[model samples]
Target: MNTDLMINRGIIKYNGNAFEEIDDVIANEYPLTIIVDGDEFATMVCTPDHLDELVIGFLASEGIIRAIEDIAALSINEDRGFAYVELVQKQTMSKDFFSKRFIGSCCGKSRQFYLHNDVKTAKTFMKQIEISVSQCFNLMTKMQEQSTAFQLTGGLHNASLCTKDQVLLSRSDIGRHNALDKIYGYCLKNKLSITDMMIAFSGRISSEVLLKVSKIGVGIVLSKSAPTTLAVNLANDLGITAIGFVRGQSLNVYSHPERIVS
Candidate 1:
């Protein structure tokens, strides 16, 4: 966790019927407005750090751009919390599309069905990435260990990009969508392929999260928490392996159990 992402605040603690005043740190919630071609695309509420990654991931997931070359001009005003972007080819989005995106941009909220762009961009993975049961458990352990922001504020969700054998990158944010966006954006900016990779998450798997993995071309998604019924269904439909309850030695392969060997 970056020091800029958290702040110390005075708080009260009640333990064993005793009240005490203490200082505590809390994660900073930042709302960054994304302006594209001088028009507001959407506003994302997330952790203060990784503004660039957050913007990139959000745009990529929303089917705005497939590669970094699509962006012509990009600048972030962190002090004012705004990201201005100009695409190489200006995209003409319908009013309906922008409305849907604005409403569904937050972490706690999501649209059950795919957006128009999602239908065009969402991937179906027929390829399988094999992982053992032990590997899944170990990966979850590694993700937890790297979730420093969660340990600090206890108010953030973590998202990690990993292979069958090792965790590669981990990002945390106050919003589940933002956390995944951070990692997803990094991959996009760096030109990394996620088709052979997976995501280890600290939050529950929702349809939104599952769809994100699908868009990112990740074959597998592992989470410490449970998966929603809709998420499991979508994962099965998209040919993705959705695993949950990945704690300790036991785990549940909600969909695509075939990918989990041993």
Candidate 2:
């Protein structure tokens, strides 16, 4: 299925004076219901591409699956917009999934408090991957150039896994978290080591974003937008190098500045 559609030609008004008919590419959004071992998991509204990766990534991030081996089988029916994931071990659903929280593109509804021990044990990344400032800027540039969906619809978030010089993988979705999940799923399925990798995102850096990066043991995150105060604090606690507002040749290092060489 196509991820975007050129639905209709419409007259676009500019500057309140001139108008022209233009073909608009609209990004597709749909509800993808995930079923884990016949139990209905959460349904997410996202773009249709990379459904398998999204499912695997979501399960992994939720701590439902500790490793790729935990997933026994996976099937995605795009026609029905459902993903069936069978795990090797039956797991209990997280309480957060059933709580009443307003889920957003960046942060989910619940405000989770992480204990120091919990952060240190499960999510803290202590990798020593140092990237130059120029490399950070260049990685952001590569991510931007690879965001074909965003350029086509101007209504999608892009995320990428990268090294110091090149983007290894990129994914797009209407939700920021979904884009990152797609990348996560891809890496996990391929057994790629994320310890020394960095993530470049075209969205605001939020606490949830930090958690996702931490879950995959990625050491750095770069964003073309701002970082929330809580996100910065979490990055510090998680030992992640968080850089935001990356444009052209400028960026603001929010945490662990030592990771970005001069």
Model 1, 1-262: lDDT tens digits are 3665788889999988899999898998888999988888888888888888888888888888888889998999988999999999888975357335333443443333566676666788899579999999999999999877788889989889999889999888888988888887899889997767888999999988998888778889999999998798778778899999988888999888889999
Q: Which one wins on TM-score? A: 1
lDDT digits (tens) for residues 1-262 of candidate 2:
2544212335575757787667667777888999888988789999888888899888778767767899999998888989998989987645354333433343531224543222322477786789998998899989999887678778889999998889999988999999988998898899987757889999999887887888777889999999998888778877898999999878999999998898
Evaluated against the true structure, the overall lDDT of model 1 is 0.85
Candidate 2 has what TM-score? 0.86
Residue 12's lDDT in candidate 1: 94
Candidate 2: 10-residue stretch with minimal lDDT: 109-118
Give the alpha-carbon lDDT of every model: 0.85, 0.81
TM-score of 1: 0.92
State in Å the error of residue 47, model 1: 0.2
